[model samples]
Target: MDRDSTLRVEKTTSLKAVVKKTYVLDTNVLLHDPTAVAAFKQHHVVIPMTVLEELDHIKDRRDKTVSREARIAIQMIDKVVDNASPQDIQAGVPVPGSTPEDVPRGTLAIYPDQRLIGDADVPYLDGTQDQANDNRIINVALSLQAENPAEFVCLVTKDINMRIKAKGSGLIHVEDYRRDRVLDDIDLLARGYEHVEGDFWSMISEVDTLREGNCTLHRIPRKSLPQAYPNMFVHDDQEFIAFVQRVDRDFVYLRCDSRDSLMHKRFWGLSPRNLEQAMAMSLLDNDSVDMTVMTGPAGSGKTLLALAYGLHAILEQNKYSKLIVARSTPPIAEDIGFLPGTEEEKMAPWLAAFDDNLEVLHGTDESCHGSITYVKERANIQFKSLNFMRGRSFNNAYIVIDEAQGLTQFQLKSVISRVGADSKIVVLGNLAQIDNKYISPLTSGLTYLVEKSKAYPHAGIMHVNGIVRSRLAAFAEENL
Candidate 1:
């Protein structure tokens, strides 16, 4: 933000208009927020023809969310193209009320009185059609800036590097606020808390006894605290213990109990395949622990194990009241609509992952005495989409987040805050199979949990390495 930019914003009547003042929307931006064009209102919004070309390329993806966004964009383009007239043609449409509904939506006419800009002259301006998707969007902004040298041509994108490129291209660039900006440190900290105790090593070795209640132990080494501290306690009083635990080796093992093991099998479908599962189960089984994160590869069984545990806690143990599960349906830069149904119907495809896990728990035996009905009757399970999760709190429940690799840190934080008292959250995702390019394994929500949740006794992190799904799936995960 520069002085001129600051003054310009101050002078602008509305933030939306200020944001859209001579704006060039990148294709990713459109995919990230399908309503972006609508939100910009009367301002000139440019959608490079190449962007439409790219949307056409991804219109047939197997993933529902990606395919839906691409399809919706095509429809929107058609609406604009249909409304534009040869005489008073503004790009495609004049943008609703700004011009007229009959004028079509999303048409751009830089100068109504000047010679009309032809379609053939579109691609040859600032950005070359051969450039990358992000680069081409930037080029469009630059070309627009070149045409309207007096007006500020702002390029909106979720891509950080693209914004930097726009600046280099001598065009103003900004991140799309609708989908940009992850959770802040303060907000993220609200999901869990950390406390350290006097000693580390000795206490970790006595985790089983410590979780049992009525036990007094002294801290031995600052390093052994995280392993020794019971996974249930997350408060200022536990900081000493966690800090001491951090002093030891980077990783520590958690002790698992029968309750934890049962829950793991019930929610996720399988049991402890490696040391990580043992530790995760230990933390999850403990009443004091409020949140636990499990990260691994595709066949590592993170989602299955977490779901199994959640199911066990709710059904067999009569612990939580319900099982609420969530996951991001990619591409991360896409809308939730275009699935051709309501919200629940839209999420059906993504929820299939959890449904398959539940099916595994139900077993293959058809004559198993109404096993499907038995499980449904025993446990009140609900699958929810992230879009509709806002402004809701879940109390005394088991929450599972699958495919967490696609969530931004902000989204993870939002989900965690929804956990009420006596509720536990299980976040599991395979970082290796991440489909969102804006985020990687190390920077994803799952990774953020593993890194930040370490200081909280009530929060634990586990990384699964061994593959147990199937030989083919395991081989693909390992070799591919």
Candidate 2:
């Protein structure tokens, strides 16, 4: 067939196809992932000039973390824009699915397209109101959507309210799950059941026959199962017991020995009470798991155990480069700036609890200020602000997110996405003491991380119970 004949054949052929258009990105999104700007191949990725301005402002901050972020953003733009032929910022960066011929370019659109859906109401220069940053991002998405009503205009943001606002404003929206990638509970069922010896129907009733160790065998009729895991097997030995699940009529659940399992062993100083430690270890033991959230009463050793595990990853296993310890700055009436000194000095109050844990781990010997410090000077320890985690890559690191219940979903995304190769993060907090009114224990970032990361191959979760700090402290935790 000739060229014309081939063209005619192609035109005559029938196939279902979908074409994607432009995607509007938020500044926070770019800060969260420097590579995100170039992520959309063959599709126009829009970065509003305002977003750039915000990047510039944040880039100039004094904080090392924010300043570093600015440097990265500047470098990315410089590399993309300066090296491109005629300065094609978008096209120079590789979009995953695009061919060489179909790469995107950073095209300039000075004015809003009046023909688009919501152009007439493009409320520009309206910064006096609340959530102005959010408003601009939404307006940009709305404007883009208005211009090409037929195309998909998604607002990609880490902000929960912004996501809700985008969805509420008749725009398609999604949070970036790239950072703290979550695994579903249903998918993790197969993994949770490491091994099973045939249809152990004979062993199901012999609950007392089971031993106390890593595997606990228990059988629950389909009715008594928790909504999360149905068809559970309840097994116990003379010493302990646990739950195993069955699905597809196969003996899919593996009863774990509760006592000697890696999850059951407690740290010398930070070992928690029964239920919390069990849950934490269950979540931790699974490399299939990605995120585990631990929340409970005070004196339950939540932070201590999390620190202990992180310390273990560093000192014993050498699985990560260093222990990265961080926490959300309390979002209460207190502000870091309001405190009476330098940033580190201002951070002292928030960091004292962490420091106290360190002291307990390795109390002052006049050699080092903290166990982490002692380890860092002797080995390698990384202590940073939650904000400092942005724009950097972490490989082989154990991240401990202390006071996690104070975090918003957006803040959580910022922290979680920084996980690099062979890294696991644990979030520890007590929801009852939450100071952020906008978030509850159930909706905190840590809770979201737990809910979302339940099924990943590398994540685990445990809720610390019982007070290990003191008898009175334990009493306060239980009774107060």
Candidate 3:
């Protein structure tokens, strides 16, 4: 071709090669997900120096989850810079992935506040006239946008107000880091059980019931099934309840016996007061299912059922060696300041629900007056903060995480990763009661685990309905 045509093609090629966008991250994004630096793939990720300062301030705090996350982000950036030359480190450095094969093609860049100090075109960010850290971060994004007009510039943060300010400041793009969100609507998530109208038992053709040890198994055609998994509960209008034993392409095998017999039977002196509670008890009683997620409102007995089962499993059945309880302590309105005590004592306030449930399970019998103490000692029950669960493994343990909705998906993964052989985990949470600003019902760790673990053979999920705590509690849950 002609020389001019070749030059034009080369110019177009270079523009296309440099067409990547720049994403400016806020401090909360790194605090939410420490590995966010590698999540941008082929784009450029910019971290304001103010974010580093924030991380430095939070790294030594008592809140282990946030503190650890800050340390991890700082270490990740340090490692990338340490491996590169001084010039490359200043300009940009490739973010290393969790695995060698997963190295991100993106570049990580640090933006200093000085770059935005004397810029005449940039204005102070929204909310205040002062030069706040958020304003400085937005200024860096504004500078990047002005410098690279050909590419898109966006700010990523978990803070809603900051997103609004960034958009108002004329930044084109803004978004929450939703890589861990497993569901769009928390209400539409699965409950791991299906209720059949009319008579479900008569619909089964060529049903064969056989006794297998302590369980009764029923075989039915696969085409007659409603979506189900092993250990999932199936109930009908006839008050007939059954558990799925195994599902094959040709037929579905169900254990026709009522595993809810445990619900009728006493568990640590507490009995299931409702159908949902019975379903939860059945799931916890079954030896085949190792992981279960339970969600309900405040007075629905989520924690009570879980703790009773944990006690029964560890103390009565000897199925597990110990009972481990953990939970996330996300604050409601404002910070409560530093709690003064040992780790377990510090976690006591968050675990008050456990104490209340244990009291109910122990009942008012004078002989069982020290039931809480007896159970805690005899069952080897241990209370732990979710913050320090990383890199530890639990074997032969019944682990129950209470108030799980406050946790992010990353925190849940950290807790779940610690489960070892001969261990079962029960995650209890009320999605409607989430207090963590960074997590919503749709993005909660409980919802994520319930959605992702649905199809697994060894996992089960149940969403408890109705409140059985008391008439007063039920009335308040409905009206106020």
Best by lDDT: 3
Compute each candidate's TM-score over C-alphas. Answer: 0.54, 0.53, 0.84
Q: How close is candidate 2 to the true structure, as a TM-score?
A: 0.53
**lDDT value, residue 195 of candidate 1:** 40
Query: What is the per-residue lDDT of model 3 for residues 45-81, given as tens digits with 9 covering 90 to 100?
Result: 8888889999999999867788888999899788767
Backbone clash pairs in model 2 (N, Cα, C under 3 Å; residues 3+ apart or in different chains), count: 44
> Across residues 265-310, which tens digit of lDDT does each residue of candidate 1 receive?
4233456765455555655776766787777777776777777777
lDDT of each: 0.60, 0.58, 0.81
Error of 3 at 271 (Å): 2.3
Order the candidate numbers by lDDT, best to worst: 3, 1, 2
Candidate 3 regions with alpha-carbon error over 4 angstroms? 1-19, 96-104, 123-130, 199-227, 246-253, 257-263, 329-346
- Weakest ten-residue segment in model 3 by summed lDDT: 9-18
After TM-score superposition, what is the CA distance of residue 442 in candidate 3 from its true location, in Å?
1.8
